[model samples]
Target: METSQTHENSIKLTSTEDGIHLDGSILWLDSKHTGDISFLSNPQSATSKLDSRVIATEETIRILESFRKKPKALICQYNRPFAIGPLNMELLPSGVGLGGASLWVETNNKKILYAPQLQPQNSETCHHMQVRKADILILSAKTPYNADANISRKREKERLIETIKKMVSANERPQIFCEPYATGPEITKILSEEGINVAVHPNLFRILKVYEAYGSHVGSYIQHSIHRGDYDTLLKPIPQNKQLRRVFPKNPVISIEDNQGPRLDDGLFRKIDERFYIPSSCDGRELKTIVPKIKPREIYIFGPYAKDYVRQLRSLAPVVKALFPRHLPSLF
Candidate 1:
């Protein structure tokens, strides 16, 4: 446990066997934790098995219904302040995926912001990330410091559209594999705006319906059908089986993978005509730019590559600490 003096009082920050604790409240940022009150940050966290009073954004609660997993969750809207005991908490858009948010808590003249999966970039299907000054900032350090971090999502989207056009022109069916919750909706919205016919997997279709309910313009899409052969493009999750060639033998297969996950081996899909990569997430360079704007008095890094993030942010923040869990508790 670490104690920091605030204007009129002191704030307690600690990581215990349960999870990250701010004062006495427990935070479940896309992780499961046990406490009286568990503040969830995103859809992933809301659906987690948590034996506590769960609180999440309104969108997240709706998404949970789509998954058919109901937990008694207290709903709150973005930028709206709600009280839980002595803490005044508000949700801010995290800009990572659908229904993603950052938690901001204020108590005793001190403010703390918890954002585990933050992306400052705007998406066509989701809200832009909102930043605010805080006394303490707990951030995730998952993005690697590399050249791929600098790739522009705008250019990548354009490139993906062009490639899909070329594949269609050559009488090939372009199958795009992406993460269902994060990149799927954005890509679908972009392709739909371009007037391209897109078919999504059943699970993704359910999620898109939730997004539509929240007023996100995901455009027009049909659920993927094994019998239908009219769509120009097909969007689905990464396949566990490599023998996809046998399933769609009528059209020449060209797979365009969203580089959000592991790269598929060439031998796994020998029949694939071509493959392309499009990655997402806020990189190390962007994190540096975002932190200064937030103007946090103290910063704590957690998640993958915590040491690297700590080193990079040490000079930018007044006090930078790494919260790498020794017992592998899911702090993020």
Candidate 2:
């Protein structure tokens, strides 16, 4: 057996789980001085009234710490090679192929969704799960904030409604969408109409700076014209089949995010064989980048309202909303 300890930070370690003292120093210490920068949602408050409440637990420490390290790109694997000393620390689930299963615990008082990623909430089924009424939705803001395509985060956007405002139950805890900043007024208005208390808080203070730099709205648009069955106007610019071009309803705004705030090039709408490509421009001269790096063959053509990519895809094929598996009625 090897050894591990957390003395002056500068962590030290070993392999054997034995030969090491299992006193106050090394109970769950699977590793040496390894540490994480993380936090958990407040437990089911004693004052709140609900049947079941979910509070983030020990995993919170690791999840946050992993993020504090500013991971390069998010992945949805359970067994990466990161060393965790000896605590047997398993990284929190990114909720990718796991389907609709979430990483957070919830109480009846609130529909708490511990979304590992902080991308826009757009899943209709996942949003519908909030039918039970949610008081809070604690989102992991850093999850897919700087995400790349062909990963779990990309899939979640397809599976879950990308609209952050509707992530929580429209009935539960007044519906709080916690991220790095505030929720859009349009979203707040919807929740208000449903009598759900709703607000968006920064999942981490570090994220707040980003929102401040941008507009208060960190997320893009909610109503994707392409997804919403409006392809006529959105498709006028495609160089492809002209028949496809006449199919869309010309819209001044490509989508909500495009209209309300700065967003990734709207041209990014198709998923072709293992990659997500979008029409991107480097220094005003636009080009299609394979998500991070545009491909040479990609025609960086801007569509109506500057959305050539999405319009082209919509002009060619119809994109559908993802169906989130509904929560089973509780045993209670």
Best-fitting candidate, scored by TM-score: 1
Flag regions of model 2 displaced more than 4 Å: 1-79, 83-88, 96-332
Give me the candidate number with maximum lDDT: 1
**What is candidate 2's CA lDDT for residue 3?**
30
Q: Rate the local accuracy (lDDT) of all candidates.
A: 0.71, 0.23
Candidate 2 lDDT, 1-332, residue by residue in tens = 23332223222222231111222323211112223222122111111222221123322222333235322222322322232233222233322111122232222222222232221233211111111112222221111212233434334333323233233333211111111112233333333344433333223333323323433332221222333532111111111121212222221222222111133222333211111111111111111111122111111111122232333222221221111112211111
Question: Candidate 1, clashing residue pairs?
Answer: none
TM of each candidate vs. truth = 0.85, 0.18
Residues 103-189, candidate 1: write the lDDT tens digits: 888887878888877777678688898878888888866545442555666777888888888878888777776766767888898
The reply for model 1, stretches above 4 Å from the true place, is 1-10, 16-19, 26-28, 46-52, 239-280, 327-332
